[model samples]
Target: MLIISPQTCTEGFAYDRGSRRCIDEDECRTQPDVCRGDMQCVNQNGGYLCLPRRLYDQPYRSEIPARPEATAQCLLGYTPAEDGSCDDIDECETNSHHCNPTQVCINTAGGYTCSCTEGYWLIGGQCQDIDECRYGYCQQLCANVPGSYSCSCNPGFILNPDSRTCQDVDECEDEPCTHGCFNTYGSFMCNCDEGFELASDGTSCIDLDECSFSEFLCQHRCVNTPGSFSCVCPPGYYVYEDGRSCEDINECDTGNNTCTTAQVCFNFQGGNTCLDALQCHSPYVEVSDNQCMCSAENPACRDKPFTILYRHMDLSSGRSVPADIFQMQATTRYPGAFYIFQIKSGNEGREFYMRQTSNVSATLVLSRPIKGPRELVLDLEMVTVNNVINFRGSSIIRLTVFVSEHPF
Candidate 1:
């Protein structure tokens, strides 16, 4: 019904040069630029058709034309494949993940997942070591290991079967110390015995100098040695039974003095002294080197009885001494008792008189006088009025009788 030139036909239609009429035109073959970039052009009767291109696969949409000066890019976490489709990246397996070595990696939608392994936890996106010891799991200390935890004990302790408790070890069994060995967990120590001390080496023993201090024990001097000391006395003294005490030597009894024959050596504490021996004068007779009696002056002195000697018997080294040594004070040891004193034996029986009474103390008294120097021996005993067995204490006494000076 209408005749139109090729240029006058609607878009995508062409004028048939042979029929002299308007007709469909293959615009897709003739003008490739006529369709949109994201669409394909198809030939139709008297026109052309445009359709969207097929998408490659998932994560990819239908073809979309990019704006000016912009490129077509896939969404975040997706990349283009060989077929121009978008595919999610497996960062977990592709070595593109940010997970720590101690963490586990998992692929997620559009991203990756990171999780910490055992004995570790996430902190600031990184796996941090877990401190199991902080929770009191171990008695002393704890350490973190890969995928697990470990327990430890302090020095001088040993881990128990539970791995959480600690126990002390016995180092003394091996005698590591010279005297005593103390064992602590993970360590051992040594100690010295009595009178000794630890050395600078920490394990050896050394002697202790006890005399270094100001404790003076010796009578004259103190001699110090390893772990012990001794007391020393002067030349005239000797060490007593007790190691630290000193006693004097009896020079007279031991015959160690320098006295002449005419000099008599008398013993005293700490030393000895000599005295001159006297000779009897006229009208006086020499009883011995040390004494004389005036038997010639009185002439009746020999007629005097020996009973007079007990009155002034001497118990001292000096002649004509008093008899105070024969006296004793009896103390009452029992609750109720009487003290009695008597002579048990004598050189001449009944020659001396002794009195016994129900008193706490008694003594033998000499009321008579002697004509010359004499020696007397006696034994005494003490008893309770009830006759209970009580041994008499023992002591020695020397006695002498002297006629008055020149028998005055």
Candidate 2:
């Protein structure tokens, strides 16, 4: 070796010429402040230098500086642990935020945000009601609720049960014709017009007849009655009761029998009949009675014991009076006087003679005689006298007759 100086060879501590101080070479282990803040110290020949620390704390952080190898343990907003490491802060669990009271906080990767519930909106970071009615969201009338709204209709209207839409009500459909119910916007009305009367049910209208007042319907004279009238006619005119119309009566044409024998009949108004008498013809001889007779030798009497008669000879000829009460008589009897008589004209011919009479006292009864003068024939034959009879003989014999004119 080389000879060392006596000053530097006292111990391991020595004085260097560059620093000119006694130095302990192992002092870095006991006093680390001897290194620079950014440098590391190592056992070089005999001195040390400064080195940087492994990690550094942030500027505003309150924790100790960290090591690079422990990056996973560093908490962003928290202080370091006693072990010089970091842990999680968990701000979501702490409930510290500026969100609205009615909002919800949702934790994100690095922070949190706020939001409202259903039917609400976030306005300026606060919850507000979404007015669904204002923007026509409701189909009908709208009602507002907390943070929401509903739909409904006003009075006098109804919402359709299916569609939820407002509609007008028809009140007239239920009670139709209620005084003529009229439907309007949301209601109905009731009334009637003039010249009409409302019925008891207030639905129908009725009419009144003005013709029941007076008898203005008839012409000359009027008789007013219930629902009808009549007209009257003057005298000499009779109204037919069937239709009440007037007509004339002809009294003269109606035959009212008022007449006597041998009379002419006439008619008048109100049914009257009249009569006048007739005359008889002249006689061949005047007899003791009111009739005309003939003697036995008279040319009108064809033979002796003479007689005269008159009668109706035809069936069509009507009858005259006293049909069955006449006789011819002789006071002095002649024994065998044969007499024959024949009717000239009228119904009397069938009723006058009887077959049992053939003597002088035989009789002929007259039924009805002809209206004018009529002639008849009789013949008599005198065989012999009964005894010596007196020959005093009157020239004429008379008879009286009564008469009725009609056949009935």
Candidate 3:
């Protein structure tokens, strides 16, 4: 209704001055360059539309696939539709995007972008793996995942339910240590009871060798046992109540000495001695070799033992000293008993003389002259005469006289 000139028609319309109204414009047949070269212009009611052809299948413009028309403009991450209009490609939904699994797919106006989540950062167009352990994310330990991290604890500790803090594991609650368990930071220790020590593995207890240590209370010989010790002494010794000091025992006082009827037992400090029996008269003395003789006050002796002792003399000069050969004291309970003696057998009997000095005793004298060093053997026979009581007596006595040239 407001037409001013014939050229005032729209780009796709025609001018009809007779009807004075805008009609359909077929610009494709009139103006050949109404649309882009990569698109074909088609006629419409009031305008012209550009359509996609098979030759415009390429994504980017290049000189090899040159077009006779101007270059086409398409939206980012979009391709031309059949009506020559840009449309979204939906690369993420179609699994055609190059975004990593740890990155999120974002559709831009012209393209799509790969981005990390809230916990991750960008690195080289990819999500950067953040070591949460380096930043002390976990209380004790941390583990990095794809786009997040996990929290953990060290030994003897466990992660809390919140997954961000740590707490003690309570290893002692499980009865891990056989002895005693002490909890510490991220670890545990084993303690022993009295008189015991912990083993190398820190899980068990071992018995302490009390004797092996230098501070052992035992004073004497110590015997070691498991967690104990003992002190002892040798045989024939008595240990005190302290279990260390010892004292000798008196065997004589305890009646352990084996003294006979003829021997007397005398006890010293730690030992005993057995002495001979004093069977001599009041004034007589006991001589060496168990012999009895007359004293100055009293000339008589009694109850002498039946013993023969050898007298060694030098005979190299063929002469001998005046030696008393024989003597016998009376053992009869009744005093004043007559005794007679005679030689039964001997080699050279004439070299000896017999003397009957008293009725209770007798003596034999050897001759002072001898031929050479020789052993002499003699046998004597004795009998009690005029005895009030006939007592037990031996009638025979064998004597051996040894003479040597070396003053024996």
lDDT of each: 0.58, 0.45, 0.59
- Look at candidate 1 and tell me the lDDT of residue 95: 83
Comparing 2 and 3 by lDDT, which wins? Answer: 3
TM-score of each: 0.39, 0.26, 0.37
Please state the error at residue 53 of candidate 3 in Å: 34
How far out, in Å, is residue 64 in model 1? 30
Best by lDDT: 3
Q: Between candidates 1 and 3, which one is better according to TM-score?
A: 1
The number of the candidate with the highest TM-score is 1
Give the C-alpha lDDT of model 3.
0.59
* Residue-by-residue lDDT tens digits, candidate 3, 146-173: 6567887777787899998988876777
- Candidate with more favorable, higher lDDT: 1 or 3: 3
Counting clashing residue pairs in each candidate, in order, gives 5, 17, 3
Q: Cα deviation in Å at residue 251, candidate 3?
A: 7.4
Give me the overall lDDT of model 2: 0.45
Runs with alpha carbons beyond 4 Å of true place in candidate 3: 1-115, 122-126, 176-178, 193-196, 208-220, 248-408
lDDT of 2 by residue, 212-323 (tens): 4444433224554433445554432345565355443333343335455454444321122343432223324544323345555656454333333222121112445445
